[model samples]
Target chain A: MKLYEYLAKEEFRKFGIPVPPGRVAASPEDAAAAAREVGRPVAIKSQVLAGGRGKAGGIRFADTPEAAEAEARALLGTELHGHAIDRLLVEEKLRIDRELYLGVTVDGAARTPLVITSVRGGVNIEEVPEKELVKRHVDPTWGLQPYACRQVVRRLGLGGPVGRQVADILGRLYQVFRSRDAELAEINPLVVSGDRVIAADARLNVDDEAAYRHKDLPRVEEGTELERRVREIGLSYVELDGDIAVMANGAGITMATLDIIQAYGGRPANFLDAGGGASVEPMAQAVEVLVSTRPKAILINIFGGITRCDDVANALVQVRQRVGIPMPLVVRLVGTNEAQGVEILRREGITAYRSMDEAAARVVELAKGAA
Target chain B: MAILVDEKTRVVVQGITGHQGAFHARQMLDYGTRVVAGVTPGKGGEEVHGVPVYETVEEAVEKHGANASAIFVPAPFARDAAFEAIDAGLRVVVIITEHIPVHDAMQVMAFGRSRGATIVGPNTFGVISPGKSKLGIMPNPIYRPGPVGIVARSGTLSYEIAANLSGAGLGQSTVVGMGGDRVVGLGFVDVLKQLERDEETRAVVLVGEIGGTAEEEAAEFIKGMTKPVVAYLAGKSAPPGKRMGHAGAIIERGRGTFESKVKALTAGGARVAGFPWEVPDLVREALGQAAG
Candidate 1:
């Protein structure tokens, strides 16, 4: 999960990493107070999960507390990437000597832990000259050796205090990256001031699957009220755009269903995976959640293995009856007495297709009519 | 003779007494898999499904001499359970639970590889060597033993494809659900290579879902195979988004695209099935060409 810069800074401070002094302000008055507390020449950064906040005028500089308050007023409550910026972070702006990049992540292919450090920072790492970026992969079994850090430092052409500080920080950061189960821990613009090096920006992406184990990291953002309610019912539901809602049993098959919809030029409104043993209530709830979209149509794709097709059909019938079906629904039922399930759907005036592509085409037709 | 499993392969259910472990344990036993032991963390000394349930995998291995293990532990403890089985010297570990963290899957996979153990799906239906051993939660009604070897990403899709192939009178020697996770222990290439080297398997069907280079890599491997290979790729219509099932399916800003994978497989010589129903015919044609 992507943590906002301010939140990442909070984590960095906790880890003994030096950061510019900052206070989060939720309002104009709060901004003035934070500015006064930090003394003048501060930066008010819009706090949002999405990137490009700075370019969007979400960040501004203020030499006075009044200017800081005015900057905060401009940033707070402004919409960026679908998130309301209720706050702005006011921090004392530092006189920079140089900015460098350092990060650690798991190598996607080799599946080995890797630590990356680059001399270029304070800008998009992708835009930086690739040859200048110093990268070293550490053997996790052997641990992050000093030589590995020196390799990055030497390539950067820094020596003495700066090199020592970077080498030490790199070692500690790699250790934290493993212990914390972080997918990404990037210190962009690790500012150097004589003998001291401080992190100016912390961009960390923690592994979502490992979220359950970490109590220290930010709690899973219960993004919306509807999502929280759906999670309570033992079915996985995520909201989306489009006019057709899809409810299915497995993730892979659900993905295939979504793909088929796109292939057929149909838009899927959401992904609802009911897992293996889905019954009437979860099914009904899933339908209700999708129906909240009041979608033009619903695509029910259940490829049962352990899950019975007849059981899913039974749930569909109950859900349609209970909810008083409004949208046009197209379903693809296969595996585990799929014939009997199709028979049941046929009896209920629901058209069931054996083919995914055909089913998607039918749903697209239904959706267009509704649209 | 089928690969990995056959009628005589004795099995033990690690994490038996749990919901899926208990359920599939009975199913496998009914399918004629000699389920000799059950391993629960502390529920040893109990009998589940007429099989002796042991506390640890070691005890089960020591007593029952079970060479194969099917894991149904919850996701958080799945890696540990897999490690236990492999450390206890089980030759094969079939993990049924899904959604274990990627790093953990990588670690357990590395550990299993070091111990010379073959690990199947961490999120999968496991392997079924029909009329022999059934070590997973796949509905057993669809399988039969023949010359066709099936390896796939989606478990139910594999079943559907296998059923279609079998109905066409081209039964499978073994069908393996390689797990859909990004960092799964075994890849399509790993399984396809084994099937090619196996004497009994005459032809192979690889059922791949889009989003990883594994399928493309398998296509390259298939180019070297003496036996014919029919490849079927799922999710041809999937829109780019957060993975709905396996974490591996997501397309970042650049790389491992559906279009690229399809092109790669086509460049290799394996006949690619455009959809699920086409698997049987494609396999048939590939086999025919091999014979000619």
Candidate 2:
């Protein structure tokens, strides 16, 4: 769950980290009002969950209230990097003496939280030379200490009051990261202006699995309608641009099904995991959701473990009877109760393939024939 | 002879009174695993599948002499369950719960490490030595005792490959699911090192998907191994920036790409299978090469 710039800044402010005066605007009129409130030249940033927004024309500057409204109007409903822009963060532009980067994210390889800071900021951290960056692993038990932050600051060749302020900000940002269950909390271009250091841009991505703990965070609607619908049904779904809709029992096998489809010269329209141990109703709902996409073909692959193949087959039969699938459907059943599942599907005028490779080939041919 | 669990290993099922825990406990018992006791916090003095349930891991360890724990606790309490087992001095703790908070997982992993214990997963199918003892949720019929050692990040994919290998007359000594979370205990390298030293494992098959540097790190370790390794990677057609089912299966910062993992593994002298079904043939060929 990626927070909008304004929301991240709000969190930053709560942690006592300085952020430029900003207001969230949902319309051109709101943008004009926000510009007037700011009382200076402002930056109108599209509140989309995407990086490199500045380079993608998702950020625009306005010198007047009318100009701010015009800039907001241009970006309000536009899609940047496939995310719909429904709101804008209108903030006063600041004078920058320098830009620095500060972030804390999980180090997957290390299995711990890592604090990253760099002298080079306002650019992609990946593009910056590795030598310029300073990184420290923070033990989750002990957390980020002030001494460690001071060391990172000194390593970046900063000293005096500004360095101390930067160190303090690092500690505060870490608190926000830990408290929010954020997978990533970053302030790119931590602007240094005269005597003060302020966060010019904020990015906060909360861990989706940790969402149960943070119910107060605003829910951002993401993905296609079908994607959202499947999510409601407790299935993981991702929309892709292809003709064949692929459904499988687990994440690994679902991804493998997509790969096998592409390997067999077919493109997958979506990736849907029915999940482990899915019973008949959610399985039926999953098929209904996939069929609603109306792809050139539908391929259902199940390597049932705790998920019985008979349950999957029953869902297929149920969906076929109720919804009446329009697309060419291919079914592959394996593992626990596979024989019973194949028998069930066979009785429904469907021949289930035992081999995934053969099933993938058949689905690709079916999709191509339909095309 | 296996890497993790075998006939000598005594097992305790955590969250034993729950649906998954009870069901898999019966399955493990049926597979000839020494499931001596269960722990359900408040459900002590009860019997699940003829196995006695205790209130805590300490009682289970003390009464049954259980050395290993299979956790089926809910995600919210998985950390406490792991901590309990680790504190009880259990040598092996396999957490079968999914959707556990990353912070909880990190803490449990650190605590497990400090206690000199091996924590398999916070979201895994558990470990199995096939025909010896099984501690996971994998179906019993697909596996058998043999020379190949399998380790994977994905459970279903590992089952698919193991079934195919068994069909091709290449049975496994053990199959380890390293879990699909971004932060998990017992990564590819840890399991690989164990398999490399196991006498029963003549060859190893690595089932990897896009995400993290675990596979890359395993590739570095694979360079020094004497036993043959076959690698099969999934998510070849997955789009960037979108997580593919697993929380860990996303490409970020131009890293953890399928191409990169394949390159690293190939350069480390491991045979990379083009598809999951192709894994058996590659394993056979590698085994043949090692024999010749």
Candidate 3:
């Protein structure tokens, strides 16, 4: 889950990391109030869970309270990079002697937390040259030591009080990263004004799996209504822009089903994983959810491993009877009582295709015909 | 002859009394795997499918001489279960639990590395050498013993590919699910290296999805291997920034895109399949080229 910039800064403050004085505003009036509270010349940043916000006009400079309100009004209800912006982070603009980058993220290859610092900052780290960035892999067991932070700072050609402050911020940043169960904790443009260092921008992405432990973190509402509904029903779902709604048993096969559909000249409206070993009710609910999408057609591809094909077939039959599917339904079911599954579907006057390629082709034709 | 588990390997099922553990234990035993014991922490001195149940991995290892462990413990306690198995000196530990915290997974990976153990997954379908032994939850009927070795990030997709290969008269030597999480134990590179050395495997099929550099890392290794590698990637039509069910299957910062993985694998001399069904034909062509 990606935290809003204001929330990330709040976490930074909790960890003793310096952040510019800021207030979260949900409306234009609140933003104006926040600007006044922060004195004058504040930065109004949209609190949307997306990247490239600055380029997308999600961030704007406000020289007065009225300008802050106007900027907030322009951004508050607008969608930036497909995320709806309802809140703004109004903060006092910092005077930067230099901008530096500090980040802590997992190195997937090394399976360790990597602390990345650069002399060059205020820009995308991906665009930075390798030589300008100093990366240190901190062992999870020992964590980020003071010497390690100082060493990285020195390598970036910094020394004296500013160096020590940067090193101190790095240590605190590590604390926030680890304690918050963050997949990524980044402070771009770690502004150095005189001897003080402050985080000008903060980004924190908490691990979804570790969410149960961190109940204090606010939940960020994301995705479409159907996407949220399917998640509530314990299915992994992502909404896409297409005509055919697709559902499958696992993540891999669902994605493959989408690819196959597109390969056969069909467009998928959504990606839904019915999960492994889904029984009758959840499967029925999954179909109901897909039907709710009001797509031209619905295709459910199941290659059962732990998930029994018969259970999936039963759900299809059950949903067909109860909900009365308004669109063309194509199902390809195989593995683990597959014969029984196909037989069950056959009795319901529904033909279950054993081949994914053939089933995908049929669905594409059906969707195109419907169109 | 297989890369990971075979007929001689002794197995211990952790969380044996649980639903998934008990069900798959029976499945593994029915598949002719040497499932000697089970560990359920408090449910010791019991019998699950005629296999002795122990409180800890140490007892299972000591009493039954079990060298491998299949864990079906819940996510919260998955790390402790893995630590227990690793501490017991079990060289092959397969964690079937999903939703394990990334920190715990990292710790397990580090601990497993330190102990010289091969941890299969924190969330996986497990490993299988068809007709020899089964250590996972994959349906036994779909696979057949043959020359092709499969290493995949996705379980059901591998099954789909393997079933197609089997139908095309190209059976697998072994199929390893490297798990779907961002941080997993055995990666494409690790499993590919093993398959490259295995005598039974003539050609390897890499079933990869978007996200992570696992496929790219495997591509680097594929360049040096004499065995032909056929790669099939999913999530081709998937939008960027959306997690495609699998936690690891996402395109971040334009890295780990389907195009990039295909480019890297193709550059490394592997035949990249456009779809799952096309994999078998590519594998056949790869084998034919190797023979020619």
**Model 1 lDDT per residue over A1-371, tens place:** 77777887887777777888987889999898999999869988887776677777787999999998888887787788788888688898867899999999876455567677788878877677768788776555566787888777888898998888888788777766766677788898899966679887777777878878777777646356766677778676666677789987766667666766776788888777777767666777777777777889988887777778888788888877777778788888888788888888889998787766688889988898887
lDDT score at residue B153, model 1, on the 0-100 scale: 81
Model 1 reproduced share of reference interface contacts: 0.38
Please report how far candidate 1 places residue B44 from its true position, in Å: 1.2
Model 2 lDDT tens row, A120-211: 99999999998999999988988999999999999999999899999999999999999999999999999999999999999998888889
lDDT of 1 at A121: 79
Q: Identify the leading candidate in terms of TM-score.
A: 2
Error of 2 at A351 (Å): 1.0
Stretches of candidate 1 off by over 4 Å are: A126-143, A155-157, A220-232, A237-240, A337-347, B236-241
C-alpha lDDT values of all predictions = 0.80, 0.93, 0.92
What is the lDDT for A130 in model 2? 87
Each candidate's B-chain TM-score, in sequence, is 0.96, 0.99, 0.99
Predictions: Cα RMSD each: 2.7, 1.3, 1.7
What would the per-residue lDDT of candidate 2 be over residues B29-80, giving only the tens digit for each residue? 9999999999998899999999999999999888889999999999988989
| TM-scores, each model vs. reference | 0.92, 0.98, 0.97
Residue A242 miss distance in model 3 (angstroms) = 1.2
Q: For candidate 1, state the interface root-mean-square deviation in angstroms to 1 decimal.
A: 2.6
Q: Could you give the CAPRI-style class of model 1? A: acceptable
Report the C-alpha displacement of residue B43, candidate 2, in angstroms.
1.1
Clashes of each: 2, 0, 0
Best by lDDT: 2
